[model samples]
Target: MNNIEFIRNEEKKYHDFCYENYKLFEEGSWLYKPVKTVMDLLPLFDNNESLNVIDLGCGVGRNSIPIAEAIKNKNGKVVCVDLLDSALNKLKEYSKQYKVEKVIRTEKADIGNYKIKPNEFDFIIAVSALEHVKSEEVFEEVVRQMPEGTKNNGVNCLIINSEVQEIDLETNEKLDVLMELNLSIEVMMNKLSSIYTGWEVLKTVVNPLEYNITRSEKPVLLKTNAITYVVRKSIG
Candidate 1:
């Protein structure tokens, strides 16, 4: 299998396994580990407020289901988008089982192709999603689509533990977004401290959105290289 085909197949295998043993992970120690780590890296969220969320590259609905439950009580919704049919089906099932069907919306689209409303999301999240997308253009396009903030100031945050290389297709330029840099809660909080202050704080804290690095010049890689970025949107 080629790169694209290989990724598709690997995704299939993953879904097949997750669908069968999802219960083992759901609310279990095995499941919420990464989630806890990710949440720790985030700013505070209110329990009684409503917000909008988009789960890009939602695979097998594992993260989607929990996200739905976490946000439902807050009157928030999670739009789960993915390219694979199997993953969507599983998300639907989980939503129904968890009684979050009303809170979760599933979409069948190559995440890299859609135009997202910039700064529109109260929260934008991805779970190990970016590394698999095939095209840098498609990936960057998604970022450009995030709609500028229309309501209260919002932000976008994404974290991924993998290799990252920023390559410009138009100019063939390259930059390093992050390297073996896991955007942990500690790092994120520190960055925000420098950015936020009394009366200057915003409603959302999702910025410096985390997308996947599509290229590489080196062979050495680290597993803890997840990066988290926060970009805030201001309500004009």
Candidate 2:
């Protein structure tokens, strides 16, 4: 299949999986926690000033809710973008419970098709997002648009899957995975450096993790390499 088609299939599969197991996105579930990487960088945002933020693939307001709460007093707003309506609906419910519903807006759009407007946001985060763009061209275009999308001195945090091995649950054998990036840490950093030359790199980390999942009544382990980057646009 072609890149766009591959992405569509992967998205459908993921949506179905999440729909079948929607409870995992409930308020108290493990996946509902704010990402530590994002939490760590929260202090950098100026609480006194209104900030425009975007959370790509903001699953169930895990990070977006807290962010909205933080910036609510400042009249800051967070635009949440995700491919699944179910996820966005859950996020809306959580936002209301958190009392930050006014500060949060949800949009359903695939990352590959979403357009990032120039100088649009003061803060942008994509936790475990962007890696789903199966098309290298699409990924490059997104990266290219980031610098312009961010206002001067704006901050951005991205946590992406750099490498991962998918295993068949029934046989516990490695599957021929076609959906994710498999770049080494160095290569990934180099690519980011090339794309984000207008930004100052504040942090770069590569985390090695083993994720266990059950499929077909068998346990499958995924050796995952996750990369986190915190960058700020250079002052013009």
Candidate 3:
């Protein structure tokens, strides 16, 4: 296969993997918790004014629900975008359960194809999402657009799996490896700093994690090097 085809195949495999295991994102599952990185940025929003938020790859309203609750009284709304219909439906249900349904909207779309309108959102989040894009070009394009997609002084938070190695937790057999950036942490940080020049970078962290998964009724662990970027656009 050519490079484009290889990338497409990999993207499809990842999507199919998530779709097949959609049950793991059910409301009661461990995957249904809000991300701490996203939560920590909540206090930065203007409490007296309504805000428009967009969450890319917002699976099952894990982060979306909490955001909705945070902004519900402020006349804020959250636009949730994801690839899976099942996941979006669950988000809708969870929104109602949390009584934030009025302020939550769901859209089903692949993040790779989803376009962000300029100056459209007050807060934008892409947690564990953008790394799945098919190519470096697409990834860079998405990152480049994020600043323009936000309103002046708007905030954007992103958490991505930069590199990972999958292993069986029981036998410790190496299963698979995925490196979205394939660049070292230092290089990645430099690239981000260069990209967001003139913008305020609140936090940049590289966190290594051991994520647990189940394959063939066996526990598997993914050793991941994740990176987070929290940035705010300046009113210019």
lDDT of each: 0.57, 0.78, 0.79
lDDT of 1 by residue, 1-236 (tens): 55576546644665455455555254632343345534542344563377788888776565667767777777788888898786788778768887999999888987776566645567676666655556544444455454342235555555544444455554555644332233454544554444433212333333233332223323222234455554555555
- Please report, as a residue range, the 10-residue window in candidate 1 with the lowest summed lDDT: 213-222
Task: List model 3 lDDT by residue over 1-236, tens digit each.
Answer: 86555654554555455544654336634465688989888888865487999999887787898889888899888999987766787778778888999999999997887888999999999988887776677777888888889998889998887767779888889975543445566766776787789999898888998867655456778777889999999998
Error of 2 at 158 (Å): 0.9
Candidate 1: where is the Cα deviation over 4 Å? 22-34, 37-43, 47-49, 147-152, 164-224
List the RMSD of every prediction in angstroms.
Answer: 9.4, 2.6, 3.3
Candidate 3 versus truth, CA RMSD in Å, comes to 3.3
Q: Which stretches of candidate 2 lie over 4 Å from their true place?
A: 1-30, 178-180, 214-218
- The alpha-carbon lDDT assigned to residue 60 of candidate 2 equals 77
Candidate 2 C-alpha lDDT tens digits along 165-197? 878766777965545556667777887889888
Q: What value does the lDDT take at residue 62 in candidate 1?
A: 59
Model 2 worst lDDT window (10 residues): 23-32
Candidate 1 global CA lDDT score: 0.57
Q: Rank the candidate models, highest TM-score first.
A: 2, 3, 1
